[model samples]
Target chain A: MAGTDTSKEFMFRPTPAIVLCEPQLGENIGTTARAMANFGLWDLRLVNPRDGWPNEKAVAAAAKALPVIERVRVFDTLAEAIDDLNLVYATTARNREMFKPVIGPDEAADRMSAHIGAGQKAGILFGREKWGLNNDEVALSDAIVTLPVEPAFASLNIAQAVLVLAYEWRRAALKDAPLPFAGDEGEPAPRGQIVGLTEQLGEALDRAGFFKTDAKRPTVMNNIRAMFARAGFNAQEVRTLRGVVAALDRRHERPNPARLRKNDDEQ
Target chain B: MAGTDTSKEFMFRPTPAIVLCEPQLGENIGTTARAMANFGLWDLRLVNPRDGWPNEKAVAAAAKALPVIERVRVFDTLAEAIDDLNLVYATTARNREMFKPVIGPDEAADRMSAHIGAGQKAGILFGREKWGLNNDEVALSDAIVTLPVEPAFASLNIAQAVLVLAYEWRRAALKDAPLPFAGDEGEPAPRGQIVGLTEQLGEALDRAGFFKTDAKRPTVMNNIRAMFARAGFNAQEVRTLRGVVAALDRRHERPNPARLRKNDDEQ
Candidate 1:
């Protein structure tokens, strides 16, 4: 009852079933269930698991994935397992001479999402842990989904493979999921604050005889104002920068009175 | 030298370093290594692994990830671990009260790719297995990367988290990886073949008295031709369809000469 909220959220949203074909290890099955649970995928179908159904080893491995394990449907054959699904993507590690469209995990997720959105049943087929999906199993699928792993070490553990697809599927389902939190930087400093800071800095620089000539004063002041405007500083940052300018101006007044007079003379 | 081709492919391409902070389990580190290797990532840094470095358990778990494990760098602290990296992303499962830009794995991967492409170092900081990264550790990161897992079961294994990020990074790095194989459907049937099939079918339909009225015959024939054109039949399909028509026509001839005479009388 405690974790039923996420399950409720997944109720109406059409999700792709993860069908494992002839999976050998129960631990692999359990871990795959866990990975599926992590990303909100509940439907898990097994086609002739070697260790058989109701495996204690799988149950033990599936820590908090009881719901997924509880609903696991074991079938005698791959066709029977995916009989009701309208679309199936067979995942493979190797390239065989087949005339199907092979796609990466991201695009596969997107396609699955669109298919599911259109009220069509969709699922992805994963093969055995050791030998992988046979050519016959792949031929049964509508398309092939492959991860872009390094060619030398492309083999992924069964659970790891499920995790990547589940993650992608969840992301695609969410469409443009907003970031969890955008820090409290709220908004940039308003124009009034920026203008005030710019004018204050201008007066301080003028007092310090920073302008070499009267003719260039407006242009230099405009450039300084433009710099402040370009920084896109938040309120806190603007306050800190203004404080820094005031501190420097104070330091100039206290440390070099003769230098200021000389600069004024030149001006 | 046997598997050096993939490493050569990664020579100049910028990749993200995987930095695990105070990872407690050696097996997790090992699996992380395997996952990184699967995705063409080699740089691995550890901030004081609990069981110490050069862990036998880790080595045993990393099946074919010797390169990643052998090149593992251990740092005294998180700062030292990420000190050289120009961009760092801290991965978290929980939504903390921090004010950083929280991004999903895909966007994070793209940003890291761009950062690395600009000749700047980038790394992703994964937290401890049990507790995860502290606020201070997250603060050091330029942004936060969170996976869109089910809220009820948001906890992901350290290795699972690494796999998702590594998978995303590889996909983003490749920009647009061609699918492993596009089945050889060859080219669609040539227009000449289509025309031949259409003419054969049209002759068969005319012989069968499918068009009842003389005035509507042209419109019905045009519709039939348009239907064939819309089907986009390939060479094999066109041949099969033509054979089907010929079989039906042959059956019609054998069935009854009397029925043909009756149809002719109606026409």
Candidate 2:
């Protein structure tokens, strides 16, 4: 149940507490906790949940997110809840009727990163499941974090809201490590291999009378070279293409009209 | 229940079908529906759901996600569900045993958006909750959608995965809405105002003994101006910061013993 003990890769980084304000149902809270846990966030704070604390419904909903559920900090008021934090961002999908500085999820995540880097506490305030953070709560927040949903139907589920924000936060924090690309792990085929493959292909094409006109020979060679260049053929692909050329060369060398019929039709 | 009639804002856009392959629990199906609703998606096709169709648990969990729930389509296999779609992306966290083009959620969303823009159908495959899409099923997809989660704990819950992918899809689809910034709507501060603010700040800092060395004074002043130049201060923020500087300047003009003692002690 400990914060650092449970968090996986981002255990060292400071994560914002998810404060649920006056949540009506226990199921949504459980679902929200699961969403937070999915993104490596554990701190859960509840401000005046309607059904009160220690609801079994939330526990039932949280499958492997029991750690987040166990350490939930219940608060009597929103002010008392956020007083310990240096910064707070109120989340609302609807365009509010207030003068607060509104920020998107990415920018909000960046600000959270900056704050956490400075060792300052930051939190995201989620309003009641029915009505989002009220005007007064929005006024208390330093800035507003709004999801970039369509204006026609911007109503996001509470758990969905938490997931989006948590996803952005985790992405911003753990962004230094680049994703592993299987293809990029391999080195590009060497110049020698490309040359060998090109020569073999040229020989094969020449045997098939591909470069018939002397005037168009240079243009055709350039086109072949450009095709190889654009293909970015790896060593294995180059070897396979070379084998194909060899197979074609042997067939063209031999008077096998039945096998050469496909090549002739393609040409 | 129809795709166009139900899809909230993106009615005109070609929406992708959410194909769940051998989903075990009905509750997860409900949660997935809720998540899809949050992103304005209504097309859901279940390929061999364990509990069969018209699941009461799914209906109960999906709060006001009636549009997605009502229009749910049941298929006998993955092939039949995705036969109508021109392109399909398989969502998988693990590096599969098969060779397939892996793309992050954002890029997958972009490709989906592009396909939709070209009047082509695209669908995403969600595997079973316990075990993800097998290699044979993954091989059927044109590309794989991998979430950027920590490799240590990359197992995201079925609904969490759905929300993340759906969120990205909606973001890529309806990206015309400009992100809300406090200063983006306002005009940027004119060069004249920036110069005035820079001079004002410089004078205030100088009075407060910011530039201790005569030799470094010009360099420091240039650096300060450059900082302001890079800030891209809007008219309102510039005036506000200038006001703050002016207030500080007034307080520093006549240094009280207490303030001077604090400053001197600090130095």
Interface C-alpha RMSD after superposing true interface residues, each candidate, one decimal:
5.3, 7.0
lDDT by residue (B60-129, candidate 2, tens digit) is 8876577789899999989999999999998876666444667777789999999998989999999998
Give, for candidate 1 chain B, the lowest lDDT window spanning 10 residues: B1-10
Q: Indicate which candidate wins on lDDT.
A: 1
For each candidate in the order shown, give its overall lDDT on alpha carbons: 0.83, 0.79
lDDT tens digits, residue span A40-71, model 2: 78889999999999999998877557657888
| Runs of candidate 2 exceeding 4 Å displacement | A1-12, A179-185, A191-233, A237-267, B1-10, B15-17, B42-88, B97-102, B110-122, B150-153, B179-267
The positional error of residue B106 in candidate 2, measured at the CA in angstroms, is 2.8
Model 1, runs deviating above 4 Å: A1-12, A180-183, A194-233, A236-267, B1-12, B195-267
User: Candidate 2 — what's its lDDT?
Assistant: 0.79
Tell me which residue pairs clash in candidate 1.
A98-B183, A99-B183, A99-B184, A100-B183, A183-B99
TM-score of predicted structure 2, chain A? 0.84
RMSD (Cα, Å) of model 1: 8.5
Which residue pairs clash within candidate 2?
Answer: none
On a 0 to 1 TM-score scale, where does candidate 2 land against the true structure? Answer: 0.68
